[model samples]
Target chain A: DVKVTQSSRYLVKRTGEKVFLECVQDMDHENMFWYRQDPGLGLRLIYFSYDVKMKEKGDIPEGYSVSREKKERFSLILESASTNQTSMYLCASTTAPTGRNTIYFGEGSWLTVV
Target chain B: AQSVTQPDIHITVSEGASLELRCNYSYGATPYLFWYVQSPGQGLQLLLKYFSGDTLVQGIKGFEAEFKRSQSSFNLRKPSVHWSDAAEYFCAVGEAGGGNKLTFGTGTQLKVEL
Candidate 1:
């Protein structure tokens, strides 16, 4: 079974503080993704990386950025955390692109900005 | 751009009752379809996916989904509902030809009554 790990399970930070959410996948998948899940809005893609050092912005990337310095790791960075940034963040990964590749997700990280 | 729609926001069913969750998609051509479930404070889990071949696909925990090209819908079904099955279900769509991005729906919250 594929496993995606998120370093932080829960965190609370003050406004204007910087936040980091780390994710790592064990299967050597080439594609990694970060998504923000809100109550009514569902899951919105934040950022994704197809290769090491290569990143692309997703639909809701306005207040977030991502780094993929290594193949098995992808990190989400919030320059300045705010109350609105308090939500659940999910990390997912999949093997090289294919018509039928299934993406696996980590347990998730709950961030609370106060 | 591909998109998904989950019409029902919340559904309640008694234990041992039949279950069906509706999902609709908008894409140019054939799109990769997937159904995912997320428990409270946890990451999303893949329930099933439809690429081609089989229109009706079986997934984990006695769940199944059927793809309909004419209606552009993939609806999830279960023969019997259990209280433990209560969770948030999401429907997602991805581009064909090995595209990496996936568009997700807002999600439906299921409540099973014992």
Candidate 2:
């Protein structure tokens, strides 16, 4: 079984504060992704990295950025947390870029900005 | 650009009743369809996926989905609903060589009545 681990399960941050959501996967998958999930809107891709040090912006990458320093680790950074940024963040990974491969997700990080 | 739409926002079903969740997608070519379930505060888990071949795909946890090319739809179904089946379900579409980028629908929240 593949394991994608999100470091923080729950967090509460004040407005204008910087926040970091960390994710680590055990399978050493080549592709990693960060997504924001909210009620009604479902899951929107924020950022994804196909290789270490390589990142691409997704549909909703406005206030977020991601870093992939190693193959097993991907991190999502919120430059300035706001009330609207309070939502659930998920990290996912998959082997290479193929339609047949399955993408595995970490539990999730619940961020609350007040 | 590929997109997905889950028409139903919320659905309620009694235990032992049949279940069906709708998912429609828009893509230029043959799309990679997937069904995912998310328990509260948890990440998304793959229920099933359709790449090619058989239109009907069986998944874990007694769930299955069928791909209808004519309708551009991939709907999930379960023979019997259980209390544990109550959760948010998301439908997603991915491009074949699009670097695993997926467009997801605004999930459908399921409520199972005992």
Candidate 3:
């Protein structure tokens, strides 16, 4: 089965602290994405990488950055975490770009900023 | 720009009852539509997608969706509901030409009463 793994399930950080969420996929997908899920607001994309070191901003990319040094790994970085950034972070990957390509997601990492 | 809208915010139905989740989208031409579900403390899972050809599409876990070009809607349906089906369902739309970016709706929270 295609597996997407998020190293952290729960994390708590103080204000202005640096936060890193790691995601890895075994399927060697070419596209990877990071999104934050909040009540009423839903899941908004932060950043996406189509290839190694190539990133693009999504709808809500402002307080976050992403890294894709390798094909299997994608990392979300918050240079200085704020309370507003506290939410469930999800990482997804798709094998290729197609009309019917299915995106697979990890278990998600829940972050709490205090 | 392509966008998706899910009218229902929350829905409650007894187990073994029928379910229908509404999803509407605004796009210039034919858009790639998808339905995803996120369980409690879990990431998103692709339930189904509709690109072209058949208007009715069958998905995993006994879920199906129908795309109506006249109404610009892709609604998900299930004949019977289970307690485990309780989750947040999101409708999304993407550009037609093999693009990786997708705009997601606010999502509908499904509650199955046992």
Candidate 1 deviant stretches above 4 angstroms:
none
Interface RMSD of candidate 2, in Å, is: 1.6
lDDT of 1 by residue, A1-114 (tens): 899999999999999998999999999999999999998899999999999999888999998989999999999999999999999999999986833688899999999999
> What interface RMSD, in Å and to 1 decimal, does model 3 have?
1.6
Show the colliding residue pairs in model 2. none
Pairwise DockQ winner, candidates 2 and 3: 2
Per-residue lDDT tens digits for candidate 2, residues A1-114, read 999999999999999999999999999799999999888898899999999999999999999988888999999999999999999899999987835578899999999999
Position B95, candidate 2: lDDT:
82
What stretches of model 2 exceed 4 Å from their correct place? none
Scanning candidate 3 chain B in windows of ten residues, the lowest lDDT window is B94-103
Worst window of 10 by summed lDDT in candidate 2 chain A:
A94-103
Clashes of 3: 0
For each candidate, the alpha-carbon lDDT, in order, equals: 0.93, 0.92, 0.92
Off by over 4 Å in 3: none
Task: Score residue B99 of candidate 1 by CA lDDT.
Answer: 80
Cα RMSD of all models vs. native, in order, equals: 1.0, 1.0, 1.1
- Candidate 3, CAPRI quality class derived from DockQ: medium
